[model samples]
Target: MYGYEITQKVKAETNGNLILKEGALYPVLHKLEAQGWLTVEAERVDGRLRKYYKITEAGDKERVNLLQSLQEYLKTMEQLFQPKWSY
Candidate 1:
């Protein structure tokens, strides 16, 4: 559920360019499920049932790791793009 909401928000934040078609989304979700990082259940919305994903404890831990790695990546990019000092 939260991941779906997050996916929607990410899409909106990127002005609809955060393209994760169902093909990609479902595969990553399935991988997470296999790794015990998430679980899914069906939920009804507007009379149609959709599979909802929920993060497990392992997923929360992975989220933290992702955030940390992203931060480090940004820092590296920033340093790499900085102008070099000239004597």
Candidate 2:
């Protein structure tokens, strides 16, 4: 998806709790493109040029790894916050 579409989709999915800004988003997109994680395609629509990004196979693998790491980190945080009882 293009940058704006991505931002809107995230906002909608999160019930407007999360918003992505272009200033923060584009740099990451460019970095992913540079890392071979995403591929970009450019097309013209309504006399305007738009760039769409698609995830590569390697990106999917990296996504899974990152998600697992995040889950583990969250679990650790949850354990840290649990109340301890002393007899």
Candidate 3:
């Protein structure tokens, strides 16, 4: 996924449709790049240079970890909210 495209996704899914500003977004991206979890490519689009981000193998593992964690979190919430049947 490209950096801009990811930004769009994050904005669309976030409340108030707020896009992440460089202050937050850039640091995370740089950290991921430094950690080898993401790769970046330079491309010329509309005659302008643009950087695109691609997920690496480490990132795939991370995605799975995050998904599993979220699933467990949801399960915990469900158990807490389940109806009590005690008489």
Using lDDT, give the best candidate's number: 2
**Candidate 1: Cα lDDT at 31:** 94
TM-score of candidate 2 versus the correct structure, residues matched by position? 0.91
Worst 10 residues of 1 by lDDT: 1-10
lDDT of 2: 0.95
lDDT of each: 0.83, 0.95, 0.85
Number of the candidate with higher lDDT, 1 or 2: 2
Best by TM-score: 2
Q: Assess every candidate by TM-score.
A: 0.73, 0.91, 0.70
Q: How close is candidate 1 to the true structure, as a TM-score?
A: 0.73
By the TM-score metric, which is better: model 1 or model 2? 2
Local accuracy of candidate 1 as per-residue lDDT tens digits, 1-87: 645676787788999987667667778888999999998898778897788788999899999999999999988987999756575
Worst 10 residues of 2 by lDDT: 78-87
Between candidates 2 and 3, the one scoring higher on lDDT is: 2
Per-residue C-alpha lDDT of model 2 across residues 1-87, encoded as one tens digit per residue? 999999999999999999999899999999999999999999998899999999999998999999999999988987999755555
Q: What digit string (tens of lDDT, one per residue) describes model 3 on residues 29-87?
A: 99989999899999899999889988999998998999999999988987999866685
